[model samples]
Target: MVDVGDDAPTFSAPMTTPSGDIEEFSLADATDDGPVVLAFFPGAFTSVCASEMTTFRDRLDDLTDAGASLYGVSVDSPFALEEFATQNNLNFPLVSDIAKEVIDAYDVSMDFDALGVEGVAKRAVFVVDADGTVTYEWVSDDPGIEPDYEDVEAAVGDA
Candidate 1:
């Protein structure tokens, strides 16, 4: 998995924008503007995923104040992501890693064999600075777990 101080692996993928439009998103381009918070979730509309995403939505201003942009990454299709964003009233974009390339690049891919779900991203968060270096990383094998919001905000400030 990617760790702090490591160069972040940049990727481009389809995403559902805040304006409910489907578009391509490039991690490198996002970092070029400022720090970026990539929140990788197992799936959309799940209980823990919903809570985690809504928490991020509520705290978006804090990250933005620190000059950071946030994006929630998932293996869901962009169409599903658009509906998910609308349902959650999320103000940030939701990246669709349907091809699982981003998850693989970050080494955070996982599977739920019993549930027949595979190639989904494990719950993870990475704070990438403008220079493309990961300033902070948080990953969890437990899908129910969520990252520390305060710590992520602090990392953005430091970045």
Candidate 2:
């Protein structure tokens, strides 16, 4: 798992933005001016994922005010993410890690054989500073659990 103070691994992937555009998104682009919150979830359209994403969408102003941008990461396809974004009325981009390369790089990939899924991303959150260093990291094995928004907000504020 990625840790605080560690240099964030650089990555770029195709993502579905809230505007329904599919484009290449990169950590470098997000953190170019300030901090970015990368919220990783197992998949899109799940109940927990919907709740978590809605929470982020609702609190976007606070996050943006703290000089941070937000992105949701999942193993779902860009098309699925687009639908998910539309359904939830999310204004942030949702990255597609369908190949699971980014998931492996971040060490957040999980196996769910019981659910008949493999190489899904674990529920995690990373706050990356403008310098490309991780300022905060949170990982949870339980997919149903959500990150502490207050802590994430604080981390972004500090960054």
Candidate 3:
């Protein structure tokens, strides 16, 4: 895992955002604009995941007000993510981690026994600073707990 307070690594990858644009984005890319809240979901369209994303969507103004760009990542493909994003009305970008490379790179990939389910990225939220340093890190112990949005706002606001 990347240590907190360490110089943030450069995170760049090709992904399709929820808006249906396939672009190669990077931590440097988002950071160049401002602080980034990289919200990682286990998968698209799951109940808890949907609620969590909806919460973010509801607070999208707050996020932008904080000068933060939010991203949701999963092993699902861009097409599936697009549908999920549309269905949920999520305006943020959703990345394709189909190869599990990005999840592994962030060290959030785990074999979660989710709802007695199978492979998935453990529900985790990472607040990366403007320099790409991860400032806030969180993971679900039971795969059912949702990350507190207030905490995320505070972290991003501070960054």
Candidate 4:
């Protein structure tokens, strides 16, 4: 897994835009603007995932105020992500890692044998500074778990 102080692995992938359009999102481009928060969830529309996303939506202003941009990453397609964003009223972008490359690169990939789900992202959060260094990292094996929003905000503020 990517650790704090390590250079963040940059990636470009399909993402849901604020206008509900599918577009390419580049980590390099986003970090060029400011620090970034990458929150990886297992799947969209699931109870825990929805709650986590809504929480981030409600607290987005705090991160932006700290000069940070937030993105919710998942293995879902851009189309599904767009719908999920619209349903949740999410203001931030939702990145599509349908290829599972991002999850593998971050070492957060997991399998749910019982559910027949494979190569899905484990719940994880990585705070990357403008310089592309990971400033903070939190990962959970339990899909029901959520990151500490305040801690993420603090990390972004520090970044």
RMSD for all candidates, in order, please.
0.6, 0.7, 2.1, 0.5
TM-scores of all candidate predictions against the true structure:
0.98, 0.98, 0.89, 0.99
**Backbone clashes in model 1, listed as residue pairs:** none
Candidates' lDDT values, in order? Answer: 0.96, 0.93, 0.80, 0.96
Q: Write the per-residue lDDT of candidate 1 for residues 1-159, one digit (tens) a residue.
A: 789999999899998999999999999899989999999999999999999999999999999999999999999999999999999999999999999999999999999999997899999999999999999999999998999999999999999
Give the per-residue lDDT digits (tens) of candidate 4, residues 63-155: 999999999999999999999999999999999999999999999999999989899999999999999999999999999999999999999
Error of 1 at 48 (Å): 0.5
* Residues 60-144, model 2: lDDT tens digits: 9999999899999998999999999999999999999888988999999999989788899899999999999999999999998
Q: In model 3, where do residues sit more than 4 Å from their true spots?
A: 112-119
Candidate 3 has what TM-score?
0.89
Candidate 1 vs candidate 2, TM-score winner: 1
Q: What does candidate 3's lDDT look like per residue over 73-124, in tens digits?
A: 7888887888898898888888777877777777777774546755567788
Model 2 CA lDDT for position 64: 96
Give the C-alpha lDDT of model 4: 0.96
